[model samples]
Target: MTTAFDTAARPAAVPGDTLVLAGRPLRDHAVLEETSRYAEDVWVLTPAWLRADQKTLRLDFTLVPPALVDVAKPLFLALLAQDTPPGELPLAIDSIRTYFGCARRFLWWVHGRDRTLRELDGEDLDDYHREITALRLSGGATRCNRRAVRMFWAYRNVLPDHLGQDPLRRSLWQAWARVHRRAGGENLTDRIPEQVVAPLLSWAMRWVDDFADDVLAARAERDRHRGPAARGP
Candidate 1:
């Protein structure tokens, strides 16, 4: 299981049962030094119990690398912070972070230097995808990375004068759309009919929800067992 505090560690908020840690720059977080170039900040969230004792605490953090934040903080804020419904921010953030991280790594692999999103052309994108394909990433991972690249370009194109001046951008967009619509292993969801996919999703969601509820119940039960004296003054 992916736990909290995978990268940086710092204290944050005490919102209800969830503790939201502040974002710490990658340079200061040693645990993330190797991956820091890809991220901007790390947000750590955990159940209150896990944080009650420092010595035994285990942290799992949400990484917001520079690749995602440097160029698109506003976009993420609008989509993840403002639009996401309550109790779902984690999922939204995770999706955004994963996609952005992959996109940044792909770009870094191709360019090997700092470059604006506007400067990249379709060839850069095609090369990255080709290299990733050659690496033989798992089907799901490749699809995820492709989607991330698509999302990055989509948002970047929205910038003023970004796409109007460059026809290559349009070609790249069209190429990805063709890939996206095609029937293949990389597009499993596309291959599956909605009727078949819906129940599978519903079942999976229910299982996750039940598992979370059980874990919370067990934690509460453990606290109750502690009693007033065991909890200390």
Candidate 2:
């Protein structure tokens, strides 16, 4: 199955154009440009700002039924390219992957019934939400899944096919917090063991106290050898 953007409606990508400006901080107000090149099943984010490990975000349309890919691809691309006013900042690679995973779940579910995004109504969304709630996924997972559904409504203007109604505004979502909320306001991250933390703290303190002057003197000596040009204006 070949994938391509509708260039007649959207602008074509210029060679060497970047999704986000170089050195512009992520999640800032900087607006992301639409690129026709990203109309693919897999997008490898090679921007200089991204870490090497976080470069690939695959939206493999092949994983879903062929009927859904046409609508799904453009919607996912729009979500990726969305960073203008009223839209949130362009997602990091990991976040994009997460959203794709969440959206894919809905796509597969819809495809099972031989339906498309355009045919979906509020009842369909309610059913999807109920299915997610029935899955007994973690609070974070459930929230992410629901947010993925909401994205269709949130970026409705940009998407070729989208939810006509707001999924979150539905009365079914009113009890979301009570149903899926985690207890105790506890942090979910695992704490580092004392044995590991102790050695790390000792090394950090040694570097700050014992090696601080030696490191500063070495930098000064290196700068002195290089002369005023190394010191800069």
Candidate 3:
């Protein structure tokens, strides 16, 4: 499956159906503010997008939240606090922390930092943006924030004003460049302390691979010492 076709010769192409928006920092700008969890936010847009595109091609946005992963920490603790098998905890944490975690952090941040507790609507998200843009998010974190915020607003129910209805959300940037700069801002990915990749795998894949190898080697060595079993015994 890992086949490579010379991409340069194919004439670069950007999908018109794919619209990418930049994410805001969850704690966007302020150091004091924490990050958000946008775990369910991304999927929340599915129905709306389906209604919009219908055919030609399905449209989707892949949000990249730089520092939004910490949101999974609570989920991890939640799992640990439960009665799930200890053996299962590590595997669950691996997926929760690695795959959808950043988006989760973005959601956690906006819910926790930008909007006041118990209040999901009626706030000026733009000010929140200004605030987030000022603080330090880990690499590609800002995009996570902005994308989550926009998607959250897009999915949230709007309140009725005396005159009409207002949008429940806002966007950090209309284009991708600003988003890339803000989220991928600084090499924050590196800022996240390098971890040995194998050390992580050792907990599962490596250990199992090692155990199998040891078992096979032990059997071979025992057979070798037996001198072909000396015919019939």
Candidate 4:
């Protein structure tokens, strides 16, 4: 029943106990202050700003099957801790939530089949890919799910229980990606016509060139009119 926060295996604080978070030196206390494990299966992560609408980014592992939860928790905890080596970065809360969705979908699929994650082989992955393809999900959605499955292999060294082999090492994946338009595909976003873009750019330039100075001056004047107490530090 040991949670991430109470785990004895948690890494000891490094020298100076400093973390470079959001381009600033964040002390250990500041990082822990924003993260809390409310239960064995739920973690609430708050960003520094703590916006009202996004007060917490909750990762609830209870949605994962009980048999698989032990294996899943460590992977997520490592990700939440941002334990990557140099040149790698931790995912933002929003990105982590997206990954969680992908992971949850895959875990539920495995659970439905009465399979354990550790027992998943490359063939099992291929069948899973076929299942995902059968769903007719958009190319992006399929890729996200595929990437989540591959994550178990990619981060295997960090996880106590992980896939024994690379899921993407097989040639079948390349064939699947090509056949499904999942690889080397151009962005499908509709480009705004030049006719529409030209007017928007012109209006933006006019605001910057003709109106920005006046707006800044008004703001400065308003700030100046405020008493020192009103502008208290």
Candidate 5:
């Protein structure tokens, strides 16, 4: 019901005279550079995010999509206000922020390099996937990249389900790159060796077991007047 960042969002408002916009008058490059930091601060205040580390703060700001950044300014500030000062933003809110930031970076290539989403065809998608591979994000961050792509396409589906970490499902993505001209990602066939996979899987299984145990432990106790049954006997 709450509209966090629905309408009003703005970066820190210094005195008008003290604020000096950088880069071209209309480019908004300096504003974006600072805005990225503002976004990072918001990330710091998120409970637990999809990204594993702080590298999201290092995202490229080449294009700074007008649609994304211009509106996001107000959206970002509004989200911060919802978090108040010391409290952390919820996980869903953090995921939304990551999705927005990722798409904003992707649009840089599509918009700044004079490439339209249509050009996602040909060899472009292949090259774009390569760039994503080079991004060096952790397992969780890679998941965020997939989420960004899902949003960029305006799909009603959540990326985690349709485009999970499972390498088997990735093959279907080629159609997206081809049809939307939005190139696909690097082949993850052997991207993650078993050495890494085994441990993650083990840890996840253990956590699931721990969760089930807690559920059992929380089972409610029923109190009754058994003395009445004994008197009847």
Candidate 6:
């Protein structure tokens, strides 16, 4: 199930041969291809909308950089052992590949070629996030970038404990992205009106109070069951 990328693992395409994205060379396809026994297909996606009933989805060749591939070959091989369905295995593999590619692009833009992942700090991450947001890449693409960087840190066990106080960073950025887009345009309004907040708060507060009472009762019952000798008499 390993998909390690090395000279032996290279596919039909190669170092001299190029993988093209919009007519420009993106990377060597051989380096990016998953060579696992489970990898029966390769899929790429372009953010097209699909209906809920749609079962068949088409993917193109994923764009990746050779340098990033070299850096992430271990992660790539690790993904081959994941439990993706046969039909979706290719997409799953490419999704992980795309994530690393996006992270590589961000790092390249920021540090040229000198910085190590261990040396990256909160300021560097902040700058990268701001730059990516300004670029306004497709939501899926942006998410890949965020997820890949997070996973890399998670793998190294070095993820930041505090992500600062930006509301976007504190909450799910994807959900907020949807809300921001809807506010700018797109009108399908099942969203709660601002005026409904006060009543909703009142309703929720009642549940909170009831839950607090239940907790107190449970504590009292536990205390009562303790024998006098055991209850610090």
Q: Pick the candidate with the highest lDDT.
A: 4
lDDT of 1 by residue, 147-203 (tens): 655544334322221211222255654565566564555443324433566678888
TM-score of candidate 1 to 2 decimals? 0.40
What global local distance difference test value does model 1 have? Answer: 0.45
The local lDDT score (0 to 100) that residue 176 gets in candidate 2 is 85
- For each candidate in the order shown, give its overall lDDT on alpha carbons: 0.45, 0.64, 0.36, 0.65, 0.42, 0.44
TM-score-wise, the better of 1 and 5 is 1
- Candidate 1: residue 65 Cα off by (Å): 7.2
Over 4 Å off in model 2, which ranges?
1-36, 46-49, 52-56, 84-90, 178-233
lDDT of 4 by residue, 1-233 (tens): 54342232523323222222333222234664344442345655543323235345667887887777766766666666676533345665556677888988888888888866678888888888888888998887887888788777666655555666667776778787767763447775555544567678899999999999999999999998884775556
User: Which stretch of 10 consecutive residues in model 4 shows the poorest summed lDDT?
Assistant: 13-22
Q: What's each prediction's clash count?
A: 13, 0, 28, 0, 6, 2
C-alpha TM-score for every candidate: 0.40, 0.60, 0.26, 0.60, 0.33, 0.37
Score residue 135 of candidate 4 by CA lDDT.
95
> Can you rank all candidates by lDDT, best first?
4, 2, 1, 6, 5, 3
Residue-level lDDT for 183 in candidate 6: 44
lDDT of 5: 0.42
lDDT of 3 at 101: 49
Q: Residue 190: error of model 6 in Å?
A: 25
Worst 10-residue lDDT window, candidate 5: 155-164
True lDDT of residue 23, candidate 5: 15
lDDT by residue (tens digit), candidate 5, 66-167:
533433333333333343222333224344556557666666666656644533553454455557757877655655665455433222111111111222
Across residues 29-96, which tens digit of lDDT does each residue of candidate 2 receive? Answer: 32345322444444443332233244444556667667766556656565555543264455655667
Query: What is the alpha-carbon lDDT of model 2 when measured against the actual structure?
Result: 0.64
